[model samples]
Target: MNSVFIRKALLLSAVLFSSVVLSQTQDEVKKENPTVDFALEGRIGVAVGDKAVGINVGGPSLKLKLNGFKIGVGAFPSLLVLDGDAAPRLSVSPIIEYKKWMLITPYYGYDAEKKMIWTFGIGYKFK
Candidate 1:
């Protein structure tokens, strides 16, 4: 209820504040040092199921952002909580990211025993 709203507000505030701090520091660094070519990005999402609420946090994924095109790799894993029961899974994939307002990477995961699965996500580049 109110607590969920409060928590979301706090998380959003923290992200914005951090982004400002990072942006300022990065700007200063560029004036003093050569630009770096690497960045890390990730996604967090809430997954809904028939009887459960789940959470996901994936990637501090590494990428090479050169001339506005990025190529990278990352993994996604999630925990599902169902009426006190839990299930978990992990999938790894290579990703290709493009800059369009923000960075979006579309991935197709291929595990040795599993079929190829496709996923799409956005990334924030730091540095």
Candidate 2:
């Protein structure tokens, strides 16, 4: 009975020691390579294509940055000021940012005529 108790105690100690060592090594690895970051960004730009011409207002966008490049998606509400008439619609687009410049492509949305359109635009990102 005493031998069995000793074996169980040794096994528990070994498990605890290995777990602590593994956690410390993981923390060290994280410290050595801290390259990813996240941020909220907003942008405004003018878009014109097909039957869509408008001002894009994007905000509260979640961005993932790795190294020097950033990638994200934003839902932008566009104010279409076409032919002296104004209307509002939402567009979701993929955003690519480098430094302070932003690129929004395949800016897909519906026009005042309820027709699908694609537009692309460049703008500045606010930090």
Candidate 3:
């Protein structure tokens, strides 16, 4: 299964398990509902490797919360003005978040030379 599907399955399992473990009676179980969270933020980071040093730029990021689950999308661009000889770079990341503001984001990127790229990052929400 794709990452998205796997994440959804895990979230479903977690909610079901929590309901079972926390429920003391039928009434309490029926009252439990997942809460949603929403946020707008910016991210800054860099891509570094041998031969060239790349700078990271800050970009808009979004998060949507449902129950204890969150789904998010972010886009980042590298201006390349500092490193003209380096590879071209652009990136997009779709992410999933869980309880306590923990986030997992797997990213795809491209260089100016059209090489395959990948990245993974973990984040936390403070607000």
Candidate 4:
């Protein structure tokens, strides 16, 4: 039973990795798969400092973005560390993203607990 859970977890990890790697950017998706109405995206970025929250600038942070919207949770505390702090700040944000014509997508969201913040980034999305 324990081995079954381990196998499932490992398989899930592989799927996520494959999605992130095989996914095409916005342009490609719009050009080839226009029929695809929504997408599931995985976001990976550096630990940019938050002025309002005073978070120590350090490593990378990963989050799941859905349908290009700002309604996702941070997927941190993985096997690899994404921040310098020992205890990760497991915060959730409900962001409102503005996807421009270009590849970049600018977002304005609050950390709810910390404060308001502005984030501009593009991520890999797949079906």
- The best candidate in terms of lDDT: 2
User: Clashes per prediction?
Assistant: 0, 0, 6, 0
| lDDT by residue for model 1 (49-117), tens | 323444555655677888755666666565545557766755444444443212222222333445443
**Reference-based TM-score, model 3:** 0.38
Q: For model 4, give the RMSD to the true fold.
A: 15.2
Candidate 2: deviation at residue 21, Å?
45
The per-model lDDT (C-alpha) reads 0.45, 0.62, 0.47, 0.33
Best by TM-score: 2
Q: Counting only residues 3 or more apart in sequence or on different chains, how many pairs clash (N, Cα, C under 3 Å) in candidate 3?
A: 6
Q: Point out the worst 10-residue segment of candidate 3 by lDDT.
A: 47-56
Spell out the clash pairs found in candidate 1: none
Which portions of model 3 miss their true places by more than 4 Å? 1-58, 77-90, 99-102, 106-108
**Candidate 4 residues 16-105, lDDT tens each?**
444554563655423665765675444333222233212222123343556754343333221112233333343332222224211121
Model 2: residues >4 Å from true position, as ranges?
Answer: 1-42, 82-84, 106-108, 112-114
* Ranking, TM-score, top scorer first: 2, 3, 1, 4
Report the error of model 4 at residue 18, Å: 27
lDDT of 2 by residue, 1-127 (tens): 1445445544554454345434543232334556976666666866555445668887557689988668888788887665567777677777776666666644555545666666656656666
Q: Residue-wise lDDT of candidate 3 within 86-114, one digit each (tens)?
A: 44455565655554333333334445566
Model 3: clashing residue pairs?
A: 34-67, 35-67, 36-65, 37-65, 88-111, 88-112
**In model 1, where is the ten-residue run with the lowest total lDDT?**
99-108
